[model samples]
Target: MTTTCLVVMGVSGSGKSTVARELADRLGWQMAEADEFHPEANIAKMRAGTPLTDDDREPWLRKLRDWITEHDEHGEDTVVACSALKRRYRDLLRESTARVRFVHLSGTGQVIGDRLAERSDHFMPPGLLGSQFDALEPLADDEDGTAVDVSGTPEQITDTALRALGLQEDAR
Candidate 1:
């Protein structure tokens, strides 16, 4: 198989990490958490209840792009969970690698807030959810991606994404 990568993207509290982790395990691919690539400054901003500006996020996005390129050159199948909330962010990813496709997780702000509150530990607070929605530019319908509803169980969500990406169980 060619080196392909799937970007599992969504706003905070949308289960991006959980779904992406399971998907990577099932697909036997290298999993990259976009959060891990964030510079300490960005993490501090979120922790302080301040949403990151586009300028603040640009470097982080570049890091993700560079990682994708490096891993692609190594012929590894990869999955990344990123809050690529804008068209421009997605464009940067496209420019970095030709093998990337996105799976966007979407859910109601209330649902996301509940999830965030229930979670034990995460930098992003529920207070940032409104800001996230304010800045979010949902993936366009014509975009080459899968839009999965995240209102159900994480397992069900992962199965949908796996089927959408054609990731098979045996690959794990």
Candidate 2:
């Protein structure tokens, strides 16, 4: 079956966007960075080192849900980079479609924090990485997705994800 949605998920600095962008390019899929969906208030809160509450994330999650449906119905494969820090947040995406697959980009706090430190332009502060981990629920092996370590280069991580998702040769 054609995979319609891919959630390149993880906490801050997990390289979700880097991997997801590469996967989407290979699959000819549209890419949506869930960060782009966050309202200014949420961004501001994170910038201030304040963790967001569930209510703060609801609108962002809903936007992702809508995008999943919008892209899937149009036969447009889409990859979304989202922290999806909790199971319930992922469930929101699941509500949109059964074809939604998740790719968990994972790394240790030090690794991710280091990566986030060198990153620029993003509103999510490195300070939020700890809080992100506090909210994460790693996917199980039986789950409908892949989990890849972000310790390698973006190419390596993306390759692992694509291969696991059976889109390895879609790079053509």
Candidate 3:
């Protein structure tokens, strides 16, 4: 059987972690946060209020792709929270994967900026929200995913994503 993986993606502060965690828990799937895969240098760069270039992101994306490969080889369903803001990035993730899908957590800059401002512990400063929005590319028609508006609670958003992805809720 092919392992199925879902990348819960969006710009910073779009509730990617919250929704991804909830969805993963509800589905009984392993959850991975993209930030955890970043090298210290990348974290430091973001902490310095500089947006990461594609060159900077290549290694990080490769690490994520490796995670997908690992889980697929083990036949485990996994959900990952990542800021896959570009089509090429998503394409890179999909390459040679078993069954990968994306769920885009999308919302307006104002909403995401407000959330970022309210966060005190994250490395991504609210000042960088604009760059994230500027670089965001909506999921293309050929992409195997759907975009969910983050106007609702995390649980609600997770439920919507589950329905959209045709995943069944955990019975327990």
Candidate 4:
């Protein structure tokens, strides 16, 4: 069987982690949180309400890419949660040897902002939600991915993504 790597992507508060975790569990794939790849400095900068520059994100992105590659080499299906906000960042992820696909979790800023405001444990400050939205570019037509609106619960979003990606049957 071919291995697949699903990148659950969106801005802060778009339910990337929640949906990705559910998807990975359903699919019996390894799951990773992109934030775990961030260096202390990057996390500190974001915690300070500073938007990360491309330079600051390069190493972090590379680490995620390496994880994808590692899983691919093991012929493992994997799911990862990441704020692949920009097209370039997504492109870097697609460089992995595995069959890389993305699920873009999309929601209105107000919706996401409300979520951010309610969450207390995350390192990403609620104020950075605006910057995240600004940086986000929707998945283009040519991209190997689908965009699922975040208007539903996490389970609904995960089901939508699986159906959109033609993985619903596989998950069952």
The lDDT leader among the candidates is 4
Stretches of candidate 1 off by over 4 Å are 168-171
lDDT against the true structure, per candidate, is: 0.86, 0.86, 0.90, 0.93
Q: Is candidate 3 or candidate 4 better by TM-score?
A: 4
Error of 3 at 19 (Å): 0.5
lDDT of 1 by residue, 51-133 (tens): 99989999999999889888888888788999899999988887765488888999998898888889768889889999989
Which pairs, if any, clash in model 3?
Answer: none
C-alpha TM-score for every candidate? 0.93, 0.94, 0.96, 0.98
Model 4 segments more than 4 A misplaced: none
* Model 4 clashes, total count: 0
Q: Report residue 60 deviation for candidate 4 (angstroms).
A: 0.6
Among residues 3 or more apart in sequence or in different chains, the pairs in candidate 2 whose N, CA or C atoms overlap within 3 Å are none
Q: On a 0 to 1 TM-score scale, where does candidate 1 land against the true structure?
A: 0.93
Order of models, best TM-score first = 4, 3, 2, 1
Segments in model 2 whose C-alpha atoms lie over 4 Å from true places: 1-3
lDDT of 4 at 156: 93
What digit string (tens of lDDT, one per residue) describes model 4 on residues 73-117? 999999999999899998998888888899999999989999899
lDDT of 1: 0.86
Candidate 1 vs candidate 3: the lDDT winner is 3
Q: What is the C-alpha RMSD of each candidate to the true structure, in Å?
A: 1.7, 1.6, 1.1, 0.9
RMSD in Å for model 3: 1.1
lDDT, residue 117, candidate 4: 93
